[model samples]
Target: MEIIVTPTAEHLELDAARLNSHPQNESRLFPDGEVYVQLESVADIESALVVHSGQPCPNQGLAYLYGLLDLLTKHDVLITLCFTYVPYGMQDKSFYPGTVNYARALLDHVTRYPVRQVYAIDPHFSHRDWVAEYPVSHLHAFPLVQQRVNADLDDYVVVGPDLGAVERFGIPSYEKTRNGAYEVELEGGLDIEGRNVLVFDDLIETGGTMVAAYDRLKSQGADTVVAAAVHGVLDEGIQRVQGTYDGLYLTNTIETDAGNVATESLVQTALE
Candidate 1:
């Protein structure tokens, strides 16, 4: 038997229903904020697949993942970990004195487990190339973004929130926009007047950067500004400035209470 586990209830909701037919596992939190996982049943599981949508609760997903891995290890089952929104992917490098490379730290921690493979969907990596003992796949959501943008394309241009996003998207030539605490700046001198613009990135958290970009695009006379991201962690900042965006699109990389575009087929592609 193959067992599929979701780290939390939110994750279980995001996972495909076909996978849900099997026994499900749940995690509970003690009053002290400690996590304890309850595996329903796995008497004779041959392999395991973990499908986890991220959480705002810091390290909660990781703790739950480790717990599942421990159980699978005891069963000597091959395991595959699929994290729709990889935690700490933004902290891929050391930025200041005594600061740890959290991205690497996360990878190292998971590598210690008997995980046969790992999928970090739409990861924000400092480097494209990596070598790990087990297979580590960096899946992209560009196709999904492209589909969303294709529905209506007229006088449209793909935009990047920053220079790095521009480089990653690799659109031959595009408008450049940057976000600052107080304001945003548009560079590259591409005229956006009366143009429909589509901005995309790997993830959107807090949305301060997207808000800045959206505001600047409108000021430059952009006809319409739509934003899309692989992971939608639209926190307080987005909540505060929801009306600033013309249309907001997000993938199911992370499960939230809000309605988001489904990403199950895209995830299935990675699994196959």
Candidate 2:
């Protein structure tokens, strides 16, 4: 299938049209040639993705869904919504007071049309088995994320911002730190006094935890602190750390204005 991708000033643009000649749909074919045509458009595709749900804050996953919907609507494609939930994240339980039924509500909304499956990436609760109610496709991201990390780094310590992330990240070499905070430690807890450090996480929101990690690493004698995440959810008031760290990297799973971050090129390449 041929795909065309466009980028709006503030959103994702997708237009897809089938280009194969068919006997039944002669009207869609070019007069001089024999190419069938279909059109699909999508805007802001990165907004609704939610890879992580703890530590920093909630990155709005709805925006990513909106963009996906736009593309699916145009192409008449069907998919299952996929996500991951941290152990103590708000979406973990429905028993908590005032907690929203995120799974149900999200499924209800997405299934309104052509969604054929629903997937969760290592959801916290065993009861998450209920997600199968709508033809679900539950999957895990740890293996994928681990594969990516293995390809990127030869030897690096995995640092979790807090206890919750320690379990969620599930890296055997993971180290836990305070919530929304960070600390630097050298060999044997001694100060590094001047070294480079790499910190990785699943999501970043409000820039609090990341910023705190940066500060802690610097204080522990690290000369530079570089951070990376799968999702960059720079909520309002948290964008102030745009250029503060040595390097802040994130995927295009969510749109942000931070420099030096990277996004998946699938959509872009598909358009070309």
Best by lDDT: 1
Best by TM-score: 1
Clash count in backbone of candidate 1: 0
lDDT of each: 0.66, 0.45
Runs of candidate 1 with Cα error greater than 4 angstroms are 1-3, 9-27, 126-134, 152-155, 172-186
- Write model 2 residue lDDT over 1-272, tens digit each, in one string: 33322111122233432222345654533466433333322232322221222223232234333444555566555333334332233354477787776756656666785655444434444245555566544344334454555565554455544344555554322233434333322222324356555566666656666666566666667665566665554554235345666655554444455423333333333122
Name the TM-score of candidate 2: 0.51
Residue 145 local lDDT, model 2:
50
Instruction: Work out the TM-score per prediction.
Output: 0.83, 0.51
Clashes of each: 0, 14
| Model 2: residues with Cα > 4 Å off, grouped in runs | 1-92, 112-114, 118-156, 172-195, 235-238, 259-272
lDDT of 2 at 30: 48
